[model samples]
Target: MTSRVLTCLLLSVLCALPALGARPVPAPAADGMAMLQRVDTARVQGSPSTLRTELDAQQAKAPKDPMPRVYRAFLALPSDESFAEFKALAVVYPENPWPHVGMGLVYVRWGMLKDAAAPLETARKAVPGFAPALWADGLRLQAEGKPAEAEARLREALTKLDIPRFRTDLALLLAGRPGAAAEARALLVRSVKDWPEQPEALQVLSRLAREAGDAKAGAEAGALLVALQPHDREAHRRQADAWLAAGDKAQAVKMLERYATLGGAEPAVLSTWVKLAVELDRPEDEAKALVRLAAATPKDPEPLLRLATLAEAKQDVAATEARLDQAAALAPERADIQVRRARLLLKLERYFESMAAYRAALAAPERPVPEAAEEAAQLTRKLHLPASPAKGTVEQIYDRVSLGLVALYLEHLMEKPELKGNLKVRVDLDPTGKATNVVVLYDSLQDVLITHSAHVAFMDAQYPPGSEPQVYQYVFRPPPR
Candidate 1:
């Protein structure tokens, strides 16, 4: 058996035991037993201070009774003082089985299985068919790796007193044995029915259902566990897994949402929830999970980018831009973010900004996108050179074109200082602001770079659409040194 099962058994021994029906006790001992039950109730009520106060009062009232003394010893468990208290009780009440049971339980809890065997046998001898002593001995034998003997003692204890603890302990033991799963499951089912608050039984039942591939049963047990321990993050996670296995993705998402809400920062859980929400076509859920995931991992830009995609799908341009901006800020050098931003700008008809974004993407220090160069070049060809040529007078339009040419000249000169001569260019434009042809009437510079730059600038300039094409000419001059 696993150490978890052993621990459960040991805790059960310390907490409470079934009534000893095979033997009778004196009136004072019965009164002490009644007071012990009250103490057990207080313990279950989850008030340690109150349980301690009640236990002390009971011990004072019946100093000679082994029942109250057993509880007192149990309260001080896993301590040398508790062992001393149980030993003194065994000496004072040699015929009572409880003191001997408490001593053996302490030794078993301490992993001193050899030391536990003697007192457990002594208790069994003091009162034949005593279920508590038998149960403790079964645990000791189980710890000592004697499964057959341990199973026999546990079964005997169940026959003497068929309580929830006995059922759970036997179920735990049988669960590890091949071909005994059905019986173990039945025992745990009955145990949980008798005591719905039994976490150990529910945990075992959930595991058994999962192993048996009974997704519905596993989900039920997991739900019970979550309800019993709402703050347990792992319980919520397991519940989600069970629900997902049962083909109830909506319920699984709810469980995962609860887990995240409860401050569960596990990336795997958040990532799974995000994926499920997307599969379910739940944009809202996806966004919520992404928001939490972004918060959980401050350095990760993936969640923010996903959120941006989701917002864009919903046509929420503002939110899309906001999320993308946040993601870009987080990873300024990400080529993917720059590409996405460029696409968004292109969609918005902000051609210049889009080109700038594409250039940024292409200029990334690492993983520079070579394809963005083609995209930016294509964008420039598609743009209108002068946005509203019809709205400006011819002189105004010529001046704007001349200023644009000067800016390009200065920009290129910074890279090529030898290109100092000016060129006379003739440009023919269609009424729709498209440059159809360009000829360098005279090129004092006679340079390929200047010719290409002038041709590109005139072709990309926007113009007004008219019934016929328009032709214009300008003489370019280099600035004097």
Candidate 2:
């Protein structure tokens, strides 16, 4: 998708919550857990057959040690069939740290992150400074809405984390830290060199390379990842995306096509391939992909929704509307349904309807992801806007937002260079949209920024050329860390 569409979609998804709640659930007994620890006792003592006998003897007695259940979850993972079973164990033994961790593992499997958070947090709280729980909860927090907390958790996790995958996981989350990507990249380099078959390290390296604006490096890392993990669909898909982003559209098509042949046309990959086809305007290729999507998942609405996204991408307003209407009918409660409807309305210049649809999405009954919903609400606000125009049709809005009147305010400063700052100006205007007066309510927190110049600049900002501005106030500080 284009950056605008992606931004709009992200805005809708991210605004779905007030800081994530997901409180702790009831836990299983640790006494029972201790008893069940005997099963591992046999393993520790290097007795395999005796381990089964011990477990059987124990199961015959209590018939319920949470450890057996947790160990079972650990054994059943990634099969895609054990999610419900693991969930049941987690629900039945909520107090047992094992179940929660197992639940978190299940969440990772499905990429439905919020499910993992509460359990992982419970584990962290239960065993403060526990490496496994700390690392897992740190990753979960990163997935939730608090990056700084995630970083702190990860840092704490690293001090105690001695897992085999420690370096890889640390390298991945490290990329999210400001000014840490260089270090992360170096770490990943060493990790991949030592564990050449580790797809995660290569993937992190690839992403870091992309962030550093070195597409060739990204592509090389991506290609290496796919070579190592040919069966891993995500590696293939990321390689394709990296190739596309690196301006090698042809390579992207080839890689994606290869993945499709391997029964690896994930919704995201299919959507991406379709996007490429649309860009190429190769109707045959596009038609093949659409046909493949329909044949593979006739009951899935995602492909149809993707069709609408493609139409929106082309600015085919009527066609996009029709497609979204169809998709919404198929899956009315799907967030994507309302999101698409909003975007279609926005594309049609029906701002009010667009805003309503976005709001409906926010209020929808289905559990909305915190990040996604927050983003949606923000987008709806940005797109619907207020009843005033920042500029007329001819002039750019930014031009008007920063007017010569602001320069007048700067002149009024009558001082040496003051740090530039931002103050959100609310324009309450007359009927004709002229700003009678601009008020500055909150000064910036930074001494450098909240200086005389900032106050003068915001106070002097003019409304649009022919209209009044709305009245608003801003809380400001230096730019984010």
On residues 1-481, what C-alpha lDDT tens digit does candidate 2 reach at each position?
A: 2455345334423432123344433233334333334433344344546655654565467443445434543544543434444455545444446656666766766677877777777766665655666766776777776777877776775666433245666777777778889988977777666555555677779888988999988898889778876676666777888898889887898788777877884666776777888798776577567656755666777667666666767777776787677766766666657876876675565544565566667776663544546655554334333224444432344344444324433443555344444454444455554445444554443332232322223333344456545433333222333
Error of 1 at 157 (Å): 1.2
Which candidate achieves the best TM-score against the true structure? 1
Which stretches of model 1 miss by more than 4 angstroms?
1-47, 57-66, 227-232, 261-266, 295-300, 313-318, 330-336, 342-355, 358-481
- Model 1 lDDT per residue over 50-160, tens place: 766776797578544456556766766766767766776666566787778878988998998889989989988987777788888999999999999999999998887
Superposed by TM-score, candidate 2 places the C-alpha of residue 426 at a distance from the truth, in angstroms, of 98
Instruction: Give each model's whole-structure lDDT.
Output: 0.74, 0.59
- The TM-score measured for candidate 2 stands at 0.32
lDDT agreement of model 2 with the native? 0.59
